[model samples]
Target: MAVSKKRDKNVYKAPRNIGKPESENPKWLIPTALTMLIVGVVWIVIYYITQANYPLPIANWNIVVGFVFLGTGMVLLTRWK
Candidate 1:
């Protein structure tokens, strides 16, 4: 007669092939994302320091532009492997 043991119902077992190779990010990914982030920060900083007079004559709209750059950079970073 063969005897078998059952697995614990509450325990979790990971698969053998769990460690897949990491995917490589595109050559432009890092630089572009970093640039966007830096540019966004600088844009906002300048806008504040200049009392909303520089970067763009649009005043409050400059904040929107800066945030857009920041958002784009963040989104790009999420795709990195």
Candidate 2:
């Protein structure tokens, strides 16, 4: 049996932005996400540690506030691509 040494010349090329540094990621994405997440957790933590003083002194409002921040962060993550 004999074999042929022919190769396919057709190749696919990806878009330019695929490897560009500018298309890596949005500048405020990570920072904003982190800020919301961290602030939410910290606020809840502080609320728990300090009953009614500093930050928000409202009763049980801290939970709602924390959740809002956390939810916003999660929403932002969805549009990362």
Q: Which predicted model would earn the best TM-score?
A: 1
Q: What's model 2's TM-score?
A: 0.65
Best by lDDT: 1
Please write out the lDDT profile of model 2 over residues 1-81, one tens digit for every residue.
Answer: 899978777767778777546555688998898899999989888887887464677778878999999999898787676
State the C-alpha lDDT per candidate.
0.94, 0.82
Q: What is the lDDT of candidate 1?
A: 0.94
> Candidate 1 — which residues are off by over 4 angstroms?
1-22
lDDT of 1 by residue, 1-81 (tens): 999998788977787767764677899999999999999999999999999999999969999999999999999999887
Candidate 2, superposed: residue stretches over 4 Å from native:
1-24
Candidate 1, after superposition: displacement of residue 25 in Å? Answer: 0.8
